[model samples]
Target: MKRAVIGTLLATLAMVAHASTPRDLESSAVVDGTLVLAKNGTVQTVQIKDEARYGKPIADMVRKAALQWLFYPVLREGQPVLAKIDMHVRVVLQKAPDGNYTARIKGATFGDMDAKSTDALSNAESNKRIAPRYPIDAARAGVQGTVYLALRIDRSGHVTDAVAEQVNLANIGPDSALRQFRDEMAKTTLAAARRWTYQVPTTGRLASQDHWTARVPVTYTLNDRGEANPDSVWRTYVPGPYTKAPWSDKSDMDSVDAVVNDDVRTEGAGPALLVSFHQG
Candidate 1:
């Protein structure tokens, strides 16, 4: 069966305090898990892989929210059937005017890990993921975002063309200024991506094709405090518009907007969510 994702509006949850703090106004964390959905489309069970790493309060809140989520049924042969999806949830931390901090569900996305889509190229090796240099202006301004990239690779595994499909900014500002930054970042990412190479599938259905188009994301972030960016913690950003690549298949446009930081230097990374569940 051709893989497909159920479409729905983004969900937001009410803010619940995790701890009292006035230091930072906004931050986010990504929670990875597996969700088992019943034929009716309700989440039957969820197992968070690193639940303890996010603390009990946040863990409990995530679990509660997951149970309440409703999804369109996954169909096999035109019949609703049980399905399991790998999900990634971005939990944002916000500080209220009163100096109290609360955690809320920012966004979530579902994907099938076992999907064998021939349209997307696979990563060759871990070391092959060469991260692009961060734009100087963006770094000076503390601007961060993920650049969704569309790359055209020849059968010989060399990138022949590259384009920035979208650029989501972490910090907010006027639309004009945001566009400027997006252009700057996209330019830098495209420069680097043009030099990238991928592994062509030898046994897949499209191996004989002259070229393959692949989609990836490149993230630009700063770690000024001498600490590596935590896998669990994510930067909250405003997503940019999706631009279809000229050589891309129209079906590729159906991808969700939720992007994860893991996509920055990795290949075939799952979608990272960017929706808010609740408002307080």
Candidate 2:
């Protein structure tokens, strides 16, 4: 996806947090005060209730809470002045689907480590890490082959290995060229893969372990006249590194990728072949 589109999508996703209610609110209070817009556009406030404690004296949080209460000081001919404001402390509760209970704080959104980390996994970050080694566009134009690599990501968010899972280039006029191209692309992609970082949420003070399996499709196309088509595509399939092996050697090798390729023959006029150099 384009960068702008991806950014817009992420923005939309972030807006979802507004609709989310805080799990606990009884412990939190809303500090009500009149927001006096100073001549310099800064807000000045007078605290009406001094009994409430916000754990930490964070000015930003206090200002945000005050703004939500709609307590702005009255202005005279665009002149700003200080005014009194009402603040209240209320206890809020949220009932979960499992009959569990949680505290809900008004105007406060609970921070979810998982959601935060997931949002950080932007396409730009992925591209920056993956582009150099794979040189995706160039590899596709040079050789008409598909290389499948299985990537193993360690707990440290590093690509430990990217082993060749499959290579499909049966009908190419020169198999050696296609194979070499596949090997080089595989090496490049794997080399870049090591630099890619996956998102891992924090579990309390410690970070939770995380791993991801992603498939990158690289295609080389040839027109009816045997010229590079630029649209022919091949894909890389990385099975779940953290989950159970989807297909064991003792089990049937037929997978969703295999089934789909079986149904659609590429320009090579046959189903794609997956030759495993080393079994996982």
The numbered model that scores best in TM-score is 1
Give model 1's TM-score versus the native structure: 0.58
lDDT of each: 0.63, 0.35
Model 1 misplaced stretches (Cα beyond 4 Å): 1-29, 35-45, 52-85, 89-120, 125-129, 204-210, 225-232, 250-280
Model 2 lDDT tens row, 22-118: 3321122333233333433333553433423333343344554444433223344555444332222222334677967454323211112122334
TM-score of each: 0.58, 0.32
Q: How many clashes in candidate 2?
A: 11
Where in model 2 is the C-alpha error above 4 Å?
Answer: 1-126, 132-142, 201-214, 220-253, 256-280
Q: Model 1: how far is 187 from its true place, Å? A: 0.8
